[model samples]
Target: MTVATARAHPNIALVKYWGKADAASNLPATGSLSMTLDIFPTTTTVRIVDRDLDRVVFNGAEREGTVRDRVVRFLDHVRLLAGREDRAEVITENTVPSAAGLASSASGFAALAQAASTAYGLALDDRSLSRLARRGSGSAARSVIPRFAVWHAGSDEQSFAEPVQAPPIEMVIATVDAREKAVSSRDAMQRTAMTSPFYPAWVTSTAQTLESALEACRSGDLERLGRITETNALRMHAAIQGSDPSIRYLTPRSWAIFDAVAQLRGEGVLAWATADAGPNVCVISPPEHTAAVAERIGALADVVIARPGPGVRLQETDA
Candidate 1:
């Protein structure tokens, strides 16, 4: 028997990944930039067992359904890579809420990929491990990279995440609604891609936006970076709203938070707001203003202040 455990941090995309280029390979339609957060990480342990079926426990509960299926499917791929037929027993503990657009899957799959590959005796490199993690969650690729990372949009073999240099910035995440979103990001992205007229524009403009954002990061221009992050996020949500049925993840509370950020900006505060595929909002600011931003947003909802975090790391291994 072999056992391994890994921990990974969830990332908030500054330049969002709202759609997939190739659904089968889970490739992003366009490149994205993100900062892996230090708070609310997920830890996963993988153990090879002789049983035919894999067992999965999440947050101390017996996990079944799509969540469990995703873990098992990832394990199956790991087994295939290692040329081992043994099933796995997966134990996951997440500080972030699952299916809530908080990038829970990003950290979850990153830890799984690391732990499962180690336990299966696959000495995969960082890029290979990122590619494998991408199979489980698209943003999981970025979580495999330390601190700020960029996920390149490319072929299955070419697409992966690499660390990027950025100035010191902090995030204030407001959990407006922590429950599972009404529509999954997968379903919502597909619908937006197929039906929204703005998708083409989004795809075309995202590449340019990413270039500008990267330049902002390189130059340590917090104002430029924050502007790009807030605008790009709003643009992605605009594409989603243009879908045939109109999928809306941002709620009134989310709007209120955005308004507060705008208000802070009007008052000479360097704060910018962004969100994933859910109702929660994240405000990015310099470390000096993180406390004030969090305190202001905290009045509206629960706030978690986060800084840039490290990549996935193995905690233990036994053979």
Candidate 2:
């Protein structure tokens, strides 16, 4: 096969997915909606050829272990679907920091899915591609689309692929800490799912949160969306507290910054914060208020603000 390339977006969850209903399938334990970011994403190139070697390179290094497993699984799925078993060479690069609690896995795996499917001449639709990506990482499923996308909770593959109708919405991500963390997303999710008693409550509340958030987005009510997201993140952390041996993602600095954002909201600044599996906080505000939010957030130590941006797309070398 000829060379093929694809770029996948990185998504930040408004309603978080903290566990898995089906670990092997990478099914979500809860429903979620995410906004894909423009600044950070993954770009991949895949070539299928009659080579004796199967190789994968990521960010100038040869990948191994779970990373290799994810690539192999994606390629194997592509081969199975397209009826080709040619040895493949894969190259991937990420604009986002890896393992820093950002959604690198979502972008990386989605890029792999897109590249592999393209290389193998597969005509898989978005839902089919999403299901394939989901097997690699749960959140990766939502990264397959642009703008705002939702992943529905269901019993089986067909049921789980159901899409939610939502309009495009703006999101701003603030990078508080970019260094890689000790815990991996997979490990964190499994630990919390097995140990957290509040996991049930997290799952039950997602539907309501997602419904309200979508409605808020549709009506251009940034305040409503921000409120739902902030509450959803708090609920996710509550599950972590319920875990045996209880873990928390919050740092002292994180709380300080969060409190600062809360203070701003109290001052009628229209600012709100949400977090993923890490200490970094993502804040949402209107385009007009984005600069104000960023300026306020930047006052806190070591915080950087990313402004409103588009979904993932191919990188133009000239631009």
Candidate 3:
């Protein structure tokens, strides 16, 4: 097959996904809903090659060790599905910060899944592609659907992510800290599942939040959606904090941004904040006040305003 390329945008969860029910399967313990952001996308291209092992290059640098191993392992899933034995040459460029809780892996793996499958002549539809992407990163499943998505916690066949009935909302991401976190999201999630005292409560709360988020999306209730996003994110972090060692991702700057958002909301600006696995804060607000919200949070951190974006899609090369 000829070369194939795909692009996917990072997403922030409204109903957070914290634990894995099955580590080996990468099955989320609870469902999640997320909004795809227009900024910070990962574009991936794949080409089948006559090589003994898969080669992965990220942002012009050849990856080695664990990163390369992980990419190859994920590629195996694509190869098996496409009935191809040939290795692949994979190159990815990510606008999102790596390991910074910005959902880079979500967009990265989603793009890779689409590009690799297309390169291998696999005709998997969006649902099947979402399932395949989840094997690499759980959040990637939601990234396969545009705008908003809800990932269900069923078996492989039933646990696919689909588009939710939510309209687009303006988003402002406060880049508080772009550096990689001390503990990766995967490690933190596993630890929380194993040792967090509030793990059960988090799971239950996330499920309820998912239902509410879906409804808010359908009804275009930005206020309710913003509230759910922040609450769900805080609860997810609480579970991490309740773990044995207690992983902390949010920093003082992150807190400041949250406080600013809260103050803005108090002023009736509709600003709300949610953090992922890093210190960076994502704000959900209306388009009209996005500039003001960004200006308010800009004092604490760099800001980027974005909106809902499209999902994983393959494109032909100019060659």
List model 2 lDDT by residue over 91-196, tens digit each: 8888988887778988888888777777788766788887877877788888877667777776646523334444334444656678887777777777777888
Give the C-alpha lDDT of model 1: 0.93
Residues 1-319, model 1: lDDT tens digits: 3899999999999999988889978999899999999989899989988887999999999989998888888888898999989888999999998788899999999999999999999998999999999999999999999899999999998899999999889999999999999899999999999999999999999999999999999999989999999999999999999999999999999999999999999988889999999999999999999998998899999998999998999996555
> Residue 298 in model 2: shift from native, Å?
1.1
Listed per candidate, the RMSD to the true structure in angstroms reads 1.2, 2.9, 1.1
Q: What would the TM-score be for candidate 1 when compared with the true structure?
A: 0.98
Clashing pairs in 3: none
Clashing pairs in 1: none
Worst 10 residues of 2 by lDDT: 310-319
Which window of 10 residues has the lowest lDDT sum in candidate 1? 310-319
Model 2: CA > 4 A from native: 159-170, 301-319
Residue pairs with backbone overlap in model 2: none
